[model samples]
Target: MNQLLNLRAQVVKTLLSVQQGQSLSTILHQQLDQIAPKDRALFHELVLGTLRQWFSLKALTLPLLSKPLDNPTVESCLYVGLYQILCTRIAPHAAISETVTATKQLGFPALSGVVNAILRRATRETEQFQQTLNQTHGLPSWLYKRLKKDWPEQLESLCQALKQSAAITLRVNQRKIGRDAYLTKLEDTDVQAQACPYADAGVFLKQSVQIPELVGFSQGWFSVQDQHAQLSASLLPNLDGKTVIDACAAPGGKTAHLLEKFKPSLLIALDQDEKRLNRVTENLQRLDLNSDHVQIMAADATTWQATRMVDCIVLDAPCSAIGVLRRHPDIRLLRQASDIAETVALQKQILQNMWQQLKVGGTLLYITCSILKAENEQQMIEFFAEHPEAQEEKIIADWGIPQTHGRQLLPLDQQGDGFYYCRIKKIA
Candidate 1:
């Protein structure tokens, strides 16, 4: 019992630190792998569930706090505690006891009484107190305001989708095995999956599985990618021998997919972060994609000089990542309204600089994992105004909402992450 309390306290402490400006993903990466395998899933569940429902919990607990807690960590613990009792399958009595016992583990032994009192009171008046709670659309006020102001029509549905967890989707390497053959393998392994209609290689899993444990994971028969993201590689023009660059490619999903589908004479996987670039290399090696045919560069595409312009460039430009809030809960907490403007500026810089690297009349696929208009449709509109030589090519896909110059895939349950893609042809 005490052991469980200790683990719960540690998880709460890490989450609290993450709430107070630390990266949840970074902290989880360092800690989750070290935890006992049996506890890892629950640990992830508690952390993710707490963050997923944080807004509702905050509203429920506001009136319970008579005075401000001395430490933010303790305050965060109460949030997760509420989540355990109200959301998880954990028994209420055990949750209350463990949470109260955890005050000492959080280095605040004196706050045991405070934690117990608040949690017990919350438990007794749970339904009534929650009814009075105000919602922040499960987002920071500033961001909620922006999303509402920009997309009033879709704000409700969009926020709802942002609160849900994403499903695991895979893209098969048809070069190694046919989709039907892969499905047969999955059936033999007792794993259920369905073919995704949007992308030829995409597969939707009925249940999530670990990456390394997947049947053909190491064999390079398939790769993990969102069904929506699979569209980026699918939407591209034929690259039978043309040069292609996955600008901002890290972890190399699209790069590998492009290689698996098309015979790009030369593919350049470029990223600004060398640490992240190594991940791209590792992914390529694991997928058994031709490392020799691809040039992995650690230089920023915005400034890197190319010997010659490439025939095609897939600029997965960095943005606010607002569309993928559910996948990365920390994004909702860490990203601010001001960050969008900064990202927009950086995106503009990357787009303009990389446009110089595309051969005349070549295809430049501009993409972002952002739902905001400023970062998607509006950005493309602004880009067109500046570069008359750049002509918007129709994204000839049945998926995603067609925008003035691009296709916007607002995240839905199965549609995958909210992504924007605009195919541009350099007419000049």
Candidate 2:
């Protein structure tokens, strides 16, 4: 009983940390080691599950409280308890008992009765609670309003997509193994997977497995990348032996993909965070794609200068990351409406700086993992006016909706996260 109470308390603490603006990933990485190995999975599930339906759960529980709880930890405890009761197959009695015990364990013994009463009331009103949740859209008001204004026709479907969990997709490293051959190996092990429709090298796994335990993980058969992200490399023109730069290239999935697809004379994988650049190096070494031709550097994209004009530049600029909320649900909590302006400013700075490095007639593929027009189509319109030398290169693709300046891929359940892409060429 003490062990169960400790585990539940840990989950409440984690959720409170996230509520206070810490990223779920960073907290988990730092604290997972402290949890008992047997309890880590439950702790993860409770935290992630609660976050995924945070707004919905909040709506369901708030009505039960006479007034809002002053203590954030107690509120988080209620959310964690409510999530398991509604979402998981766990029995309501067990969920209520464990949560009530955990409230006392968290040094709130006086409030244990409050926690027990609220959870019991919730269980008794399960049908009514679900109805309330169904009416709630599960997104903060600002985001909901923004998305509604941006995608009026598709808003309902878009909300549904963001509410669900994302699937595991992999991009095969063709330099090491063929897609079909890798599928066969997975099938031989009774691991179900299928080829992705859009990307020639993409595969979708039926179930999540420990990545390193996969058939060719150690041999670098593939890298986990979304089907949408895999589309970026093919969007650019041929670069058999041209100079290229992947700006903001830490955790270098696209960088490695570019190296595999085209033998660029020089490929500079550059990012501002020197510590994150280690991930780029590790991925390159794992895929055996590291070579003298590929140079990884730590430098701000907005200020970094190329010694020579480059044939191509892939600027995967940072943005609000709204498109990936389903995969990173904490984003719904961490991101704010006011953050968009700041993100747009930084994107403009980097775009202009990277443009200077492109030779006349060289291509610059601008990309963002954002669905907002302010960060994508609108940003491009302003850039075009600022730089007359920039020419729009229409991406003629069957996927994604064609925007005035780029293509917008909406998030889809069990498929790809939302992403945007535009190609531009410099003209003298």
Candidate 3:
């Protein structure tokens, strides 16, 4: 219990730091690494859940607070406590008492009354309080307006989807084992699972379980990956026995998928950070997909030059990650509206630079976990306009998907992430 409390305190501190202008994930990494393994996991759940539902919780708790908590640390601690009352099944009394005790430990004993009162009110009038929050959309005004304007028909569904917890998915490593054999092995171990539609070897877990507990996990039968992220590999046609580049492929999820499926002649996984590249190597090593066929390089995708033109290229450019707000709520709070322009520019530079490396008739898969039109459709539109040689292949909307310039898969669906992908072929 002390371990949990300590980790929770660390998460609260990290949240406070983020509120005070520190990088969200960066500030939490070392603190999270210091906790025990199980505590670390719980810390992640609590912090992520709390952040994801913050607006709603705040709406309920604010009216009950006598005044603003004033201190950021105390405010964050109160938010954490209120989150437990509203989201978790913890006994209301224990949640309140323990959290108030935690505040005292954090040198905010004076605010215990405020915490106790707000949490007690939250528990007592749960539905009424929640209804008020729910009616208001539980999002920042700017974000709510943006969603409504962009997806008028689907805004409610999209917002609700973003509020729910994300599903656990696995990217099966076909290099070591077949998908069916692995599914059977998982079922035999009492793990409920199903095959994801988009990827050849992807699995959707019916329940959340630790990755290490899965059969053949240590042997690398599969690695955790969203079904939506696997789309990049599927979009690349005729990849077998050809050279390919996975640009910005750190922690190489897509890189491994490419290797597992196509077993390409040359797979160069490039990312700017050398340290993160270690995760790519680790993932490949576990999948038994690590081979002379693949090369990990540390270089910026925007500037990296290939010695010879490759048959295919994947530029999974980084963006605001708005499409995945449910999984990473910190992103919504972390990003500013202006960040999209710079991201689009960088993506253009990488696309133009890497387009040079793709031989005529070769396809470049441009993908991002972003739902914004500027980063996805508008970027692709402008790209196609500038490069008359490239043609836009629209992903059909009758597929029960939203329309964007390219393929815009909502995070709500079975086989998609809030992803945007365009398979641009270079004309000779």
Candidate 4:
């Protein structure tokens, strides 16, 4: 096998699966081992870039097509080639030749001509072709229409932001190293980083690196979390000696933060997936924050609750996850307009079920990685109507747009991932 060509071939297969409705994260996680460690980064870049800009490439290639190709898998292979040409820094001659060679490796020797012709024409014309010529902003019409309706003024900027990669932000575990100390350490190692504007303990890495290789990673000096998400645990107030539950907590970034920052009488971190719950345990153990007081449970909060009402509760309610599109580009392809309504219904059910567990004076912080009104504000509206006892507590923050019932951080927010937070206090 041509090793370099083989890497591109693997990327083509991954792209095909993503185009077939499989998520890029799942497919890449399962297939990463098959790729040589040296090539994994490029493999990820090619596959993710292709998916993120699928339509942008379509705008460039559609006219160049001799005709619509029959097999989408073959078309996917061509997309990997074209993505390398138009989007990546790969030299055009090498990108085109290597990708065409992979067609035979992918068992489509006959389609090599079709792939070759389109990519060659792209290199010749793409320079001037992209000059006011690329109109499609790489969004499916269904998503574009919905986003336009929801955020008429911001949709264009949001779409542009979605095509870019997200910055890797870390929440420094003050237990191991303070944020300022970590900033100095990053400098010593030539890793470019700076303080996060919002979260005091947050560090924004100017250039991303493999998480494990960062100094003190083994000692749990920090956790890879979005700067916006780091605020979730901070929104809860005065947990000293109070019972708290982080419902839907998994891979527990917020759970770890809550434990690290406050002395809770009992902190029960619950998530439905047993496998994912283990991830929460791993994170806690690595941070040296896990103890008897912090119990990791694999139970669905919507269906399960403790005998006693907790003083503080975190419902990081699952929703469409439409907000984190920059980090999870596959969402653009996999998500449908209908998924929003389905997710809204489930979020409402979870909110209703979990509200019963909050003490009269207790606080419940509702969060989602979705900016959709259906999942954010409108859900708050419906929840308020059904539960007269629930009052929207003000989120007195300097960041996020203040919504009628909550604050939402759009994706383009300088130092944040798209997030929505609604703090409520039970006042009946």
Cα RMSD of all models vs. native, in order, equals 2.2, 1.7, 2.5, 1.8
TM-score of each: 0.95, 0.97, 0.92, 0.96
Which candidate's TM-score is highest?
2
State the lDDT of candidate 3 residue by residue for 116-209, as single tens digits: 7777887888787666756546666667777787678788877777777888889888777888988998899999999987667789999878
Worst 10 residues of 2 by lDDT: 1-10
Clashing pairs for predicted structure model 1, backbone only: none
User: Where does candidate 4 stray beyond 4 Å?
Assistant: 1-5, 132-134
State how far residue 254 of model 2 sits from its true place (Å): 0.6
Residues 1-428 of candidate 4: C-alpha lDDT, one tens digit per residue = 43445777888877778878998766678778788788789888887888888877666667767687778767887878878877789999999888887887888899898999888887887776555234567787888887898888898788887777888999999978889999999999999999999998999999869889999998989999999999987788889899998899997989999878988989998889998898898998899985779888888766886888889889999887878887888888789888888889888878877889888998999999997888998899888888888888899989988988999999884577789999999998
Full-model lDDT for every candidate: 0.83, 0.89, 0.78, 0.85
**Candidate 1 local accuracy as lDDT?**
0.83
lDDT of 2 by residue, 316-375 (tens): 999998888988999989999899999999999999899998999899999999998999
In candidate 2, stretches whose alpha carbon ends up further than 4 angstroms from where it belongs are 1-5
Error (Å) of candidate 1 at residue 109 is 2.9
- Which window of 10 residues has the lowest lDDT sum in candidate 4? 128-137
Clashing pairs in 4: none
User: Who is ahead in TM-score, 3 or 4?
Assistant: 4
Q: Kindly list the per-residue Cα lDDT of model 1 for residues 1-428, writing each as its tens digit.
A: 33455667867867777778787866788777666778888889888877877776776677677877767778777877787866667887888888877777767878878878877876797676445432336788888888888778888887767877998888999888998899889999989899988988988899878878879988888888888888887778899799988899987889989888888889988998888888888877777877777999889776887888899999999998888888888777788778988999999999999898889989999999888989999999999999999999897777888888899988867659989999999999
Give me the displacement of residue 61 in model 1, in angstroms.
1.3
